[model samples]
Target chain A: MTDFWLAAALCLLLTMALGLVRVMRGPSGGDRILGVQLLGTAGIAVLLLLGAAFDMPALADVALIFALLAAVSVAALTRRRLTREDS
Target chain B: MEMTLQLWSMLCVGAGLFFFAVGTLGLLRLPDLFSRLHALTKADNLGLGLVILGLLPWAGDGFQVLKLTLIWLLVLLGGATGAHLIAKRALRADGEEMLE
Candidate 1:
């Protein structure tokens, strides 16, 4: 089980790297936003994995909070994009 | 017993990671915003779901599993909704029809 989670974590890290590349090289604003969104999702997964591996229940709450924040941020950004277009 | 649990956990984690990798690749390789969104949503949902599954065996009990499950649900809901909103706003802003 420990080995399994470790491997999974490693894979998730690799995924993060890929998303990071997109963030760095994204041609447009929307691409960057998508990259960041991907990162947020990956981060939440990592946190949950840590919580379970370390027996830290509080980490679950942290993941929850992060998810909420990510959601709100995306919404705000989307709204901004819409308004910018209108103007 | 513990050993078996650990192995299963590893498999779950590995699957999760694989999904993440695929998502990342899609994000980088896809041409358009809508296509990228497809990759992001699919990868994020499956990747996180796998991670949660891997951790389930080690969780203390039913309550802990329940908590984890709830978190998973929240991720799915939040991720999908957020992506949808972003895509919609982007489309409307550009005067482009939303992609299915």
Candidate 2:
């Protein structure tokens, strides 16, 4: 079971690396940020799987923090863009 | 019963992994920002939710279950709002660029 969880986490990490390709090739800011969003999400899933695999519930808390920060980062950037445009 | 639960967890987690893969593929191949955003948010949240569902049985107690549920809910809310805001920003920037 632990092996299975770890393998799943590896798969997610692969996908995240592929997502980074999008970030690299992005022709627009929106696309780039979207790729970053994908990274954050996959990261959370990987963290959760690792938590489960290692029998450590603490990683869930880390995932929760990742979720919150992921949300805030994008929103903050968007807000800053808006404010900069206004001024 | 233990075997059954383990099998169930594997199944759910496997499905979640598939969704995450599909979401990433969409993000890479989708034509434009709006469509890519569409793929990102829906697939990302659904995949994450499925992952959490799979982990539920492994949760040590009621408290762990609650914590997992809360995390999923937070991700869902945050993803939706972030997607919306990103879309709005993209639209505004597009309009501004055209004006220029």
Please name the candidate that would achieve the greatest TM-score relative to the true structure: 2
Q: Candidate 2: where is the Cα deviation over 4 Å?
A: A80-87, B94-100
Where does candidate 1 stray beyond 4 Å?
Answer: A1-4, A81-87, B95-100
**Could you give the CAPRI-style class of model 1?**
medium
Best-performing candidate as measured by DockQ:
2
Error at B6, model 2, angstroms: 1.1
User: Model 1, residue B93: what's the lDDT?
Assistant: 66
Report the number of backbone clashes for model 2: 0
How does model 2 fare in lDDT?
A: 0.88
The complex in candidate 1 yields a DockQ of 0.53
What is the per-candidate TM-score for chain B? 0.86, 0.92
lDDT digits (tens) for residues B17-55 of candidate 1: 778888888998888888999988988789889878878
Residue A48 shift from truth in candidate 2, angstroms: 0.5
Report how far residue B78 has shifted in candidate 1, in Å: 1.0
Q: For candidate 2 chain B, which ten residues in a row score worst on lDDT?
A: B91-100
Q: What is the lDDT of residue A8 in candidate 1?
A: 57
lDDT of 2 by residue, A1-87 (tens): 999999999999999999999988888777878887898888999999999999999999999999989898877766633446677
Which residue pairs in candidate 2 have backbone atoms (N, alpha carbon, C) closer than 3 angstroms, thus clashing? none
